[model samples]
Target: MEHVTDTPTVKAPAERFTGDVFLHPIATPAEPARLAAALVRFTPGARTHWHSHALGQVLHITDGVGLVGTRDGNVVRVRAGETVKCPAGEEHWHGATDATLMAHLAMVVGDGSGDGTSWLEPVTDEQYAAALAGPGR
Candidate 1:
């Protein structure tokens, strides 16, 4: 068994998110034997841009409420203690709701050949607003 050393926390990129957000990388691609995990904190209305994983991604909600949206027009409201599985290459976006702060442990599974994630463009305000408007609005 190998013990990992403590690592410093890092601020999430402003370009990748909105509002106050932070990320703590628990593992990385370099450690393929281990799953890549990130502690993600989102301020009210903060969220990630639409993206996908080459392998897939799992999210376990730690606190508050989160919203996960898909290109097929599915928006799921996930709360603390809930686990969400996003299938490989499924275009999706996730973030905190407008009224709450949210945090989740995001796990990105490594592809045997590397190239585990593929990040797309940021979610446009128009898309977000439309999502907030609810279905058939």
Candidate 2:
């Protein structure tokens, strides 16, 4: 058994995120381990840029409300205790709602080539609004 000490939380880079976001890395890909995990926190209206993983991702909400949007213009509202699975190579973005602070644990696998994610572009304001207004929950 390994007792991991608490690590410092890092602010997400402005180039990759909008508003204020933070991350605490839990585990990272290393020799003989292809798994990566992080505890991500987003302030209201904060979010990541559009990106996709080569080996998929799993998000487990820990607090407050969050939104996940896809390139298809679909948006999903996830709350505490909800788990969301994003298929590999499907571009998506996730963030906190306008009125809520959100936190989640992100788990992902590496593709064995040290490549895990491909970042596309920042999500446009129009796209975000449209996603919020999209049909279905």
Model-by-model lDDT, in order?
0.83, 0.89
TM-scores for all predictions: 0.87, 0.93
Clashes of 1: 0
Q: Give the TM-score of candidate 2.
A: 0.93
On lDDT, the leading prediction is 2
Write one digit per residue (lDDT tens) for candidate 1, span 1-137. Answer: 65779877777777767667889887776653747888999988889988898888999999998788999889888899999999999999999888889999999878865547777888888877777677533
Model 1 pairs in collision: none
Clashing pairs in 2: none
**Local error of candidate 2 at 86, Å?**
0.4
lDDT per residue, candidate 2, 1-137, as tens digits? 66889789999998889899999999888868898999999999899999999989999999998899988877899999999999999999999887889999999998887648888889888877776666643
